[model samples]
Target: MNTPPHFGTDTPRDLVGIGIGPCNLSLAALAHPLAELDAVFYEQRPRFDWHPGLLIDGARIQVPFLADLVTLADPTSPWTFLNYLRTHHRLYPFYFAERFHMQRAEYDTYCRWVADQLPGLHFRHQVDAVRWNPEHDVFEVDHTQLDTHGEAEALGRTHTRNVVLGIGTEPYIPDALRPLVDAPGVPVVHAADYLTHRDTLLTAGHITVVGSGQSGAEVFLDLLRHRPTGHEQLHWIGRTDAFAPMEYSKLGLEHFTPDYTRYFHALPENTRDRLTTAQWQLHKGIDATTLAAIHDELYHRTLGGGWPDTVLTPGVRVRTAGRIATTKIELHLEHIQQNTRTRLTTDAVVLATGHRERSLDRILVGLDPYIRRDNSERPRVDEHFRLVLDPSVTATGCNIYLQNAERHTHGVGAPDLGLAAWRAATILNTLTGKETYPLPTRTAFTTFGLERPQPRVPAARQAAPTLTPLVDRR
Candidate 1:
């Protein structure tokens, strides 16, 4: 980096963001007009791209268009998605299209466009580590400059009063299928890279998809459309008991509201953990449109009479897997309900097993002693999104905020695009000790608990309990 003359250890920036994913990008865009707050964001990628490999044709984002980077928090901001359309001279086309939900590719392009104009966003600069200097009471962020090809060229550091971690998540490869996915020339892959390996997968004789989420459904539908009708040898299996549509009902979606998030955070830790596991369908379920497309494709093939030579099974677990020669994969699966075992062979496997949060332990290693953790040993994030740091660390007034890494503390909406701006605004409000974006006291019609501790929390939001307590202390 050129290290613009004004930015140095002696001159600390107000904030420094680690990764330029959509989360941090939103923060940067919102912070752009705030001349008082000096902030800079670093990214390893050469440019912004949201799930580039999963930008399959006809795939649409689950959230509405207004859930874009800046709109939800600051609709009038010039960086809104509407402005992206206007800038590209496609506003009329977009208006006529009436697409409430944006296409995945278009969303990626919109983010790229926004990233291009946002100043102080350093692309090709990989943030290596962050350490707090007690003497200076500022964070020292070390990063390496990368060339266009992503090769490291030089090292540099920046000093900041605060740091935001938005490194995002990583594609998860299941343990049973790890060997094949790691081996050279093996076709087993994760759905995150579906587009990158589309041609090879399309040519494969028998393909098996190992997830039932939205990505899995989209990949299966895409493959079905291109393959010959009757010869479509595909197997789609998942651990879910049944293929389920996302909970998109008006009231059901209240779970993603700020009110619900706060309520969820105050619950007992064990209860929160159980709810996360049981509420998989809330965020992990397939979108209704994608589910319909898959069914419509299958129904179209049925017009010719026999099944489309595809096996769609649920409630099955992949017990183990092995390879039969180099070109074939053998999956040992156990039917969870029936307690029966079976073996299936395939030419290629797409493990849309979903993603796991990228660890902050690597970069935050220097501050480990001062960082507090939850019962699970994961870093604890308070209601304000700041890490629950020890007094020693908090004494410096150098806060560490998190993005998309607080699902355990925040709920399913932690990673949802709709809540991105709200979270950014919340973090900014708390960071600056000012309401940059004043938020509603409550947002959801449904109150999560029977007990309302605050008078400001409306009574209409809470429902009257009709059943007696299961465990009677009386």
Candidate 2:
């Protein structure tokens, strides 16, 4: 099999993607068809694996199978989920199953299948830094290749006209639980490592799950099912007012469309910040189906006798956590609405806290002087997802792009799987300075703001797409 040639060549590439997560994989897949464009992606890990720890049995992705790495951008591309099924000779079975959402494990396998076949993805290669090279009119990217054990085996450099940072989010641990997690006595673990610690957790006498998001619900449900019926001894508590269901109504789903993203970006900085928090239900709440499954399980356990020994409470926050002697743990909790406080003792704790977008400071510190920032000191990102760099860097015809790091600007859809392909296609079009993949003029049924949005054109009435001449605005 022919692979992309190693770096250190005389000619520079069009773009160098920093991380080979699903976001960058989508970009690479879309970029693959544009013959004039040259792109490569590097990942620190050995191969592609999405949320391996939270891939609980029987769980499925939130979106439909069509929300694959390439389908939303170019359904005709050979990398679509349907094509994967056909190639694997599972098309008939999948069709008969009639499942809209694909299983989590199956989706991981599909991604690995794509990652294995894509030529330019260099796994086990860690990107170290990025800097602007005015002399060469390109961006300098330094990377280190790692062996199986993740030790640096060799160092290399690549020059590219543009760089795309797809290094995704990291598991976030709140301050209150830091010491407990860091300490060795208790089996405190994040949901990101739930599968690895499942056995240890099950053996405990009592367990407590924190956070009210989908992960928390799933973890609590899984534990509830495994524990004996009467003596479940499980406590599920979170900071939310209620175990609210995610906003899954068709119109509410439109917030994830490109139209809403445009409107959100156009808002004032403060408004965008407020909306990110106010619109939490769109992305952070538990799925209705998962909630139903949990309720059903709890109802089943109550059919025989009184009730399961589980304490499910919301509107509570963990004030702090400490070890009780050597075998147990103590948690200081406060109810947000009732203004009440209490303490709970548990044998183990599972933190289902969500992730936060990883900071790009270490990798981008080299070019800090040239990058523009917002009033809050956050790096400013434009509608095209390019970092607002100083004119000096821009005039040199070099650029840096971002994925999954623009939630402050692009709204909640920044980390969404459904928008991955669309964003990738948008980036490619911006890079090529042409409509390489003709995107729809509009995507949502609702107008985001009062301002007149582009008319929703029907497929039959849409005109022939026009190509705009490339301008060297850099």
Candidate 3:
């Protein structure tokens, strides 16, 4: 195996990555070979973790194992799921288990293992700000290092030719739940922190789970199954009519495939928006296992010959929730059909609401004047994933690329594991002026896989003309 190159303290690097999520993990793997170009990945966490809060012991990945960080884009790459299994000596046992998809914990372990093998990864480094330096045509990044006491007290700086920002999603709590975030002794928390307070909530007298997505349903089912027989009650409320299952058809799953992203990007703006709105159910829907778990809990309670303390109220919106005391919470809800409001008291309220993309406002403050925006107020990106800069800005062939930040322009595959490797290679190609990072080769008999590599077009067919008729006339 070839070792990655390193730079001296004074040597300038080619690029600096803001976060070390799976998106940039793929980039680090692909960019490893560019020895002349120095790169470093900064992560705020003390170690590698991908959605650690949601890595329930029995929870399986929504997508297949083959759709890992790099497999679909680079099957032969060492970072493939098969390679991960082989490296960990679990391939045979995994096959014997007869499971197509392993638990989310296992998947997360694989990612962390891969991250451990990679170099140039800096942890405990939280980027505080980024400023554009026009004179040097580079970005100046300011970061702080957390000390033993968890206080950020040390400051550092680095200059790079370009930067790739992949600061993942932020938990999205409803506006009404904002007050409860800092309330004293209020057992109100988002689903992302479920595991942190699972024991407390499970033992509570009455628990109400808000939202109807996968997280909400999972929390409700888990609580319903584990809570004491007659002491605890479980209540679920959502805007939808029961938890809807994700679309699992071959064609429906294609929305996260590269082909679908290409097709979606080629469509007109209005048509693309229409398609996205129409297909929200494909990705936003919950898992069937969660719904079935809820059903089983209900069936078990019915067989006991007594009414169980569990309620499922669909199409209801939470109007307000207040902490009545140190131990209880009051919720005001309005049902869609009843058109009348009602109130309920519960020991805990778990908001299983989803997440939204992190806003780029703070870090990109200096570059905001130069960055172009699309109709949705998101940054406009070029085909190479570079931010579309204003004409006034100039560079020494430097380009700021983005990963997991172009959901509107790139479609569903923007934040998915399927596209990570490809996006990284695209950025590499734009930077190196050559296709040096080739994807790994795979054999035909792989259980779950994409089609073989496609033929590359010749230079003439791929190149864009430098002098157009209008330019010549001018």
Candidate 4:
């Protein structure tokens, strides 16, 4: 990148965001109306697109429409999803349809609409590094401006009092199957790129899906519907004992509320680790509707008094994988309960194993000395979502905030869509040292722990006293 003179002025901004995914987009939308706070967000992508490869047809997001960009925190904001529909003249049609959950594609479109109109959002700009400048008492942000083709055009620098990182997660592939996917002319692929290879996969002789989550279920169902009835040759397997439905009960869903998140944050480190693994069904299970659809499709094929040529076993996992004569794939499987082993061959494989949070070591390398880490070497995040840095850094009133990177400290709600608005509001309130957005005292019906949970209500606004005119009575 061509290094040019500094692009920003001597006056530092209040906040600088590193990534423009849904989390940072929510923060930008909420920060827009606060005239007192000056903030800007940067995104590497040329435009906003949420999970473009996974936008399957007829697939709906897990959360309701109310969990939009700004509705849960500030419904009156112009960036709300309702406002988007109103401006596009689709409110009446949406109302007449009576749909609570929106399709995945529509949600992507809604985000793009907001990204197109929102100001102070610099797209095609990639933040390179962040460091503390004690001399100026501000964070130095170095970024590279990219052209439409993602080539570096120029290098610029900005100074900010605080920084927030919202870089999102990446697709995860198992180690045993990574070689198969990396090899050329192989049909093994992760579900994140399923749509791009759907036609090629559908033409294969037999297909195998290696996950039990919503994405895996959706992929299997989509492929099943396309194949012929009697000739359908498919296999679905995972590590779970059974295909379980997500915990969607009204009371069970309290786990995703701010109350539970706070309670979980205060627990012992070992206890928190155990709960995260035990609560897999909360966020990593199939939807009931999708499971029912799969069963219905299978039942329809049995009208001729013969079962469909398919196999679905839950307690099985691929122990090893390799190529079979370069024409098919071989998988060595094991049943966890029975301790039995077998081998299966398929023409193609779809791995819907899910995603892992992108590491922050590269960008935050400059701030390593000040960052306080836990036993696992992970950054310690406080309840306010600020990283617990050394006193030398905090003494200058410069803070480093986080979003969606606090799952270990905050709980599973760190990645939930329902908590995005609330978290953004909390971060803003903490940054400005005032209640920029008023949050609720309570959100869930159930109290999480025996110890009384603390109320998160913002401190009462300190209004100036009204003085009456001094009269003769004085």
Best by TM-score: 2
Please write out the lDDT profile of model 1 over residues 1-474, one tens digit for every residue. 224323355799899999989999899999999888989988888878788879988899999999999898899999999999998899999999988999999999999888888888888888889998888888899988898788988888899999999999999988887888878665888999989999999889999999988888988999999999999999999999888899999998999889999998998888989998989989999999888999999999999788899999999889888888777889999999999999999999999899999999999999998899879999988898999888877877889999999999899999999999999988888888898888889899997898765566567887786996699779
TM-score of 4: 0.92
Q: Give the alpha carbon lDDT tens digit for every residue of 1-474 in model 2.
A: 124337687799999999988899999888887889888888988889999998899888999999999999899998999999999999999999999999999999998888899888898889899988878788889999888899998888998999999999999899999999889887999999999999999999999999999999999999998999998999999999999999999999999999999999999999999999999999999888999999899999889979999999999999998998878999999999999999999999999989999999999999999999988899999999999999988876678999999999999999999999999999998888899989988999898779667879999999989999999998
Worst 10 residues of 3 by lDDT: 1-10
Window of ten residues with lowest summed lDDT in model 2:
1-10
Which sequence of candidate numbers ranks them by lDDT, best first? 2, 4, 1, 3
Which portions of model 3 miss their true places by more than 4 Å? 1-11, 230-232, 268-275, 392-395, 437-474
lDDT winner between candidates 2 and 4: 2
Residue 353 alpha-carbon offset, candidate 1, angstroms:
0.7
True-structure Cα RMSD, model 2: 9.6
In model 4, the runs with Cα more than 4 Å from the true position are 1-8, 452-474
Candidate 1 vs candidate 4, TM-score winner: 1
TM-score for predicted model 2 compared with the true structure:
0.94
Number of the top-ranking candidate, with lDDT as the measure? 2
lDDT of 1 at 172: 91
Candidate 4, 138-244: lDDT as tens digits:
89999999997889998989999899999989899888888898887659889999999999999899999999899999999999999999988999998899988
Residue-by-residue lDDT tens digits, candidate 3, 30-63: 7776687788888887778877767776888787
Instruction: At residue 130, give the lDDT of candidate 4.
Output: 95
